[model samples]
Target chain A: MAGNVIEINNLTKRYGKHRGVEGVSFTVKEGDIFGFLGPNGAGKSTTIRSMLGFLGYEGEIKILGSDARSGHEKLMKNIGYMPSEAMFYPSMKVSEVIKLAADVRGTDCADEAGKLCERLKVDTSRSINELSLGNRKKVSIVCAMQHKPALFVFDEPTSGLDPLMQNTFFELIEEYVKQGTTCLLSTHVLSEVKNYCKNVAIMKEGKLISCGSVDELTHTNSKRVIVTADGKKSDYLYKGDMNSLIADLSGKNITQLDITDPSIEEIFMGYYEA
Target chain B: MITLFKHEFKQNLKSLLIWSISVGTLGLMCVLLYQSMTEDMQALSDSFSNMGAFSDAFGMSTLGIGTLKGYFATEVGAVHGIGSGMFAAIMATSLLSKEEDGHTGEFLYSLPVSITKVVAVKIAACITGLILFSVITGIFYISGVAYLGENFETDLFLKYMISVLLMNIEIACICVAFSAFVKKNMIGAGLGIALLFYFSDLICRISPDLKDYIVYGPYSLANATEIFVGNEIAASAYIISAVLIIAAVVTAFVKYTRKDLAS
Candidate 1:
């Protein structure tokens, strides 16, 4: 699929008896916004950390054709990562923190960093300790995107941002993705995935249960249908042709009929109940 | 490596300034007090010699307080040795653990630099801080001796300072190695290392028989009186200290690269 930017196979990480992620495998293609969808403690962070070489795992992970563990430093040059919690040296000014990140990458992104600061409404003069949680998150986003890396890995990046900032962040991602930057957005927010991601992998209990495009996943599953015929109310979970259901209900004195796609929560529940 | 070193040095500048000033002021004040007692040196020396165990407990028995170097070694040097050791231990331990404790590892570790480079730069930064502290304190000390109209033995003083710096480096390495394992509770780890070295030194001082067993402790490597008096320090002391520093640094590199950072 257009030269996979990330390839993970049977990646397993365990903390003693507790499993972090077990036998989780996935691939993200170039220029694709891959959504890693899972609830809390469902191994999203574990997998991300493993791919970044921050954790030791049992299986194989390759980022841009280099082994994640052996070629970590070389691979990290073109990868940008944003954690769920954004923390920096408390004594450093926001500008200094951003500068340090750029310096570490050995690339000057002052123009991009300044633009990001302006767009994100971040005050670069303020020390890290003086900023609020959302502002700290904004600073982190600036650091992650300033370099304009080939691959971006974000773990619940929008948790602390307000709605306006969230929209701005999505717009920034969209702009970058248009330039062919591959992104892996890991979050539990279904709407974010539905709105921004083309492909998604649903994980539960440290295992991947479903993986496919959003439209395929939603349409292939059961559809919720409601029919009001002569004041007789009934809820039906239909999995057949739409015409067959319509024909069955046409002769029953149908007064109203409604059909719609099920919510991600319902689809998730259906997978669990299966 | 240069960028990381600069950032780390800037991050640690405030602590380094405070430590250097405090130690320098202490050294200056001790020299001033020694000058005040110059006329009563004979009486003070007599009393100190007779105090016996009391003098030994504080490591004051070996040096004759009548002379300028002796008084400086017994009073100011002792404090500087112990204080600088504790400072180094705390600085090294906190430098590595603070990233994880403050949840900043994800930001730093995800960069293009190798973990080995990170550790090397940090250690270099810590050493730079210690060197600055020593230089500031040394200037204050030499100024005090010169003001008191006493001879400053440049060779002996340089040797003593080198020994003290080595002692601090050895302690710092040990703490850095310890920090790699104890990711959280860094304050506790720092304090634990300080107490271990301080008490080990005390035990060696209080008993002659235990000296052989505890010679590896950092305090014994550069005893103020031994170095100040031009006595030959055992080669074993230097060898063991070097071994400890090397072992600790190697352990830090191995553990940190393989660590599962929670951040």
Candidate 2:
């Protein structure tokens, strides 16, 4: 249990008993793309902030086999963080911001910065204030990934990205994983997590209500089935299955059914509904 | 910490330039005025008197308008005192609190540097700024003294000048400490300067009997004349001021290292 790259034990952060986060625990193995899945305000950001040593809390966290509180700076040097809401000076250019970040972090990654910029198709010449949300996200992503840190802590890194750019991000993540880097991805997008993460932890009401691999969590949950009958009538659903909600559309509806597994979103919803 | 200091210093070079120009130009202008008026001592004295007690309080009398201790006291308590102190205050406040206001602190917290390092480096930068004001103004003082008379005691002026330098550093440290607690640059600078100048007068108005107790005050430091005249500089006043500054800086460092930056 202790053989993990990141180990959080009994972490509790309370703001006048408002429960910023409470008694949350988790472990991330080396090279594990761990997904911290939760909706907004479900303590995802709180957990990440605490782990980064930005906040004092009543818990012990370790990063790369070192205590997060006592060994924060040394451990964090190996991490790349992309905050959910990225804020940069309006007057600074993207290139300028990236350079400043690298300077402060004691990293020299001009080549990596350039390569990431080129791959993401980001225009680094524009001022941050003049950038669109998606482009701003691109700047943040570039800043986070430029140095190829050992651990990548992303907070909604893909929220504003287009589908094409999202695919690019996934490619980058995959590339990084191949290089033996770990990722602790925090996001509400079940589909993205399901596709890319090796292990997933789900949170609800400031607690980890359910967590595990996609297959393990959803094995007994409801399966979705879609059937294509004939070209003339394509709508179809089984009418007699008590475990399923069936709908048979008339006029160009399917005449038969094709059974498929329920998506990660449905499984996540099921945890709350149950 | 050195890296942090360098980063802060580079970031503030422009502001330093502006302050430098202001001080340089002001010193140059005053020298020019002194040059034009040295022949007419009565006219100079009348002009200096007309400039008001506040101007006298600022050390404008150091130009030898009447060649009196009152003029030197005016210079010690007023111009160089307030001007240098305020400059140090601005520099220190801006260095510590701008990160929070710009939301840059959020991003920076994620980096590998500890907040302790950040605070230490920033304090060093504040001290550097303090020295800049003091050193640059020392240059002005020497040049102005040279303009006044060839026989002025350069050694005494230099010795007295260290007290003023230390006075500026004391003010800078207090402002930086205030900035760390408040986490707002403008408000921290405003309050720090106002408190430094205001409390000095407030204690004076309240009566000399209460002077020693207002240890949390920097107006005592502003009393550079008394300190430079080889007096003890009121040991309790300076000690109290030192204690307040140390407390602020320590608290800021502790808070910065542990404060949750999510917001």
Best of the candidates, lDDT: 1
Off by over 4 Å in 1: A225-257, A272-274, B53-60
TM-score of 1: 0.93
Give the local distance difference test score of model 1.
0.86
lDDT, residue A19, model 2: 82
Task: Give the fraction of true interface contacts kept by model 1.
Answer: 0.89
Compared with the true structure, what per-residue lDDT tens digits does model 2 show for residues B102-211? 77776767777887888887787767766776677667656665666645444545655666666667667766666766555685555468555655655453454654
Cα error of candidate 1 at position B70, Å = 1.0
TM-score for all predictions?
A: 0.93, 0.82
- State the DockQ of every prediction: 0.78, 0.52
Query: Chain A: TM-score in each candidate?
Result: 0.89, 0.85
Q: Which TM-score value belongs to model 2?
A: 0.82
User: What is the per-residue lDDT of model 1 for residues B14-102, given as tens digits with 9 covering 90 to 100?
Assistant: 98888878887888899988877889997888788677655674545777788888888888777788778777877888878878988
